[model samples]
Target: MELLDQYSLSWIIGLVVALSVTGVIAGLMAGLLGVGGGIVIVPVLYHLFTLLGIDESVKMHVAVGTSLATIIPTSLRSARAHANKGNLDSALLKSLAPSLLFGVLVGTLISGLVSGLVLSLVFGVIGLLVAANMAISKEPAALAETLPTGIVRHSIGTGIGGFSTLMGIGGGTLSVPVLTRCQVPMHRAVGTAAAIGIFISVPGALGFLINGWGVPERPPFSLGYVNLIGFALIVPMTLWTAPIGARIAHAINAGLLRQLFAVFLFITAVRMLYGVWA
Candidate 1:
């Protein structure tokens, strides 16, 4: 049976194998760091799409949109696993959901309007920030035990929504750090961040769908901004692997994982920046 005709059988097999490996790596990182797989997915997809001769002008957008599309299922799986482990904070989720939802909507809209190069640059910057956070070993001395209220939480939620959507990242990169700084335990913060990914992805994805509606250069099997082909390849792989990552998280040394994750982020950041410039 011919699985894919867009390229040679060898190339198709290679692509599928690469994507599967990426899924495993991204899932492991997400589980170990509480991040959305997007940090890894976007850069990898960008390079892969370039190799496949996707248009330079729109390849970044496709990468980001497709990453977000995959994150929907991946995040849901991660959140459920964390919840089962009693790591998720219901009250914090309840308090943060509204703002997060609104932020995603706004961010998606912004993404539709922005250029793909700009999106790539933004992602590079965010990746650097994540790397910086990961490199820092010491926890902040001043930390609050309670969640922020009033305007602060709303502002942070909005920032998370916009940044996450723009880079096709799981909100966890920012959310986990913020929560940790707010005195939440690291493991609990990771769980909460996983839950936030669901809130960010749903509306953010809808916005992409709505915004990309009439664009003429969209790929085969696409809905609005998202390529269904990429989503199909990634979603199942990520979902299946995420729980495995979670299981490993409980069994391994988290500090080592975070350092390894930081190294991975640094590499991805450099690649993304290269894509933006080259």
Candidate 2:
């Protein structure tokens, strides 16, 4: 009871409702598209923390870090669901993991050195580009008969790791496209992307932990950029909802889902960009 007094009833209730909704949506998208919901989660968190009067300087970091924390469990659940369907490319995942890890470390370190406003601007720009790419890109039918070897695979993995860490995503947005370009089947690409999220998040989250160490003026229940409260609110619900998303993905038309996702990305990007300049 005493501990409860620290929070306002209205704020607590709002947080619960908001986080619950976010988890459900994120899970649905992740399961359906094999992309972690960081694109949605990050902006929502940014706005929420702003409303809560968290210091502006650390708000973006908190949002990104907390989103990564949530991705850990959510991505694991998604990967498992896809794996059960025998869609994961285990060989490819193994080949790319090392490069991904190193890239995540570098990205995380760079994130700490940058300003929050700069990060927000960058996210906004990237969001726009992702939305544009998804909206206009034609669906390719060719499939990669063989997995990438040696230098090319490593280079791609590095890009996935670095971009994912910087954007607070699970790497699916880029990974799926790259895999598709390499001629991997759409479903296989989604499953492989889900697997990549786990690889990316482990080290990415660790980077946030190390980068934000001992920073003053951080919120309560925070470790560097991550807020434990937000993580606790999101992870369980995201994990439970992921498999459901996967099931829906199998049922839904892929073209429709992609269009819907693109629209959502556009809206999110516009909102974030508006906030950056406003």
Candidate 3:
């Protein structure tokens, strides 16, 4: 109520409607695709914030931080649905969590150091590679039955964390392919990626919040860089739709799913690329 007092009633209504729609889309995408909804949320929030007149300097931060916060519950819900079918690799999830959190913190720091357009470029490039890998690769996930250990695994986990954080996406966008490449099954990879989202989203969101604390020129009701209103509105919709996505993932053909997911990733990548100039 008080937050809306800063703007016209129409603007507040429009913002709420947009966030609601975003929640639905992100939630379903995360559930079906095992992502944290960051890819979708980041762009939507960035443009929406611009329209709402957020400070140019901080708009990207707010969008990213809020996306991370919103992904936490969405991913958890999706993870639960997948776990019910024993599709999750708990050990792999654990392996990725700690280093991933650290990487996300590192990424948050990197965010302040880099411009949004630069970050968008990086996001687009990585996402495009991920999309291509998923779409074309048909080799058996026969690299290693057991997960890798020591520095190699940790290093990769850290990289995933940092990249996802920088891109404001749940690490699944990166992790699923890596898991499959490491010989993890597709369903299992998707399930575990959902679990990984918790690690990335929670820490990444906190990093942004603390990182942006007392910073000037952010939207109202912001906790550091995280927008409270957007997170609240988006989380519920994501919560509702994520389970449905998990259901679809299980029900569909694996190849078909991969193709569809690849398309989604490709589009997201191109959109991010476009945003660099748009």
Candidate 4:
């Protein structure tokens, strides 16, 4: 197609190789951080799009949407792997889904109305805050033994879904902290977050498809903003590698897991912040 003509064959091959590598890292992040790899995927897409010389106006939207699209399979794989270890919280998964889906729609609507610059700032700032929180690993003030019920669940789910959709991330960055604060163990929090990513990513990706539909200057092989080629090449690698991260997560000590994941978050936080300027 016309999109294929935009680059030389060798270049396209190179891009695929690079994207495959991104998928591997994304899979590792999905397992290690339970953030559904969206954090890694979004920024990487942004950079790759820039390199590909895609139209500036739609680059962020395409990046976010495609990242969300790829997240579906990746999340499914990572969650299943985590579940195999009996780490997931089934009750929490049921409670979070409905509200999270609603919030994703709300966030998608909001994204269409805002500028890409604003979204970049939002993602950067929030990512930095989330990374800082994880790195610190402070115990919650109340050390609440049970997850809050009713409106609190709504509040938490809505916040995670809306924000994650906008930033093209799984809701895990927020979910893990919430679970841990409720006195769930760290491993359970990670496992549960992996499951929650499925809920957030599926509806969130669909919302992006609908919201960005028919917008101008989108790159080829795209449904709304989700890039077909990128999705095709990345999903398998993500599926292949997510289990590796899960294996490592289960094998690592709590303190080691915390530190390993903290360093990743910190590095990604800086990369996201840099997106604003780039």
Query: RMSD in angstroms, all models?
Result: 3.1, 3.1, 3.3, 3.1
Tens digit of per-residue lDDT, candidate 3, span 106-208: 8988987777677778878987887787788567445676668999899989999999998888888788778887878889988999888888888888888
Per-prediction TM-score, please?
Answer: 0.86, 0.84, 0.83, 0.84
Determine the backbone clash count of candidate 4.
Answer: 0
lDDT of 4 by residue, 61-177 (tens): 888888888878767876897899999888888888888888888888888888777677777788778766766655656458888889988888888889988999877777887
Task: State which candidate has the highest lDDT.
Answer: 3
**Residue-level lDDT for 65 in candidate 4:** 86
How would you encode candidate 2's per-residue C-alpha lDDT over 1-278 as one tens digit per residue?
64357667786677667767777777677678656688778877877778777788888888888788788887797789889999998988888899999888878988989977767877788888888776775765544555578897788888889878988889988888778878777788889888899988888888887788898666667887887777887787777787898888888786678778888888877777787789
> What's the lDDT of the predicted structure labeled candidate 3?
0.81
Note the clash tally of each candidate: 0, 2, 2, 0
Q: What is the C-alpha lDDT of each candidate?
A: 0.80, 0.80, 0.81, 0.79
Evaluate model 3: give its TM-score: 0.83
Best by TM-score: 1
Q: Alpha carbon lDDT of residue 94, candidate 1?
A: 87
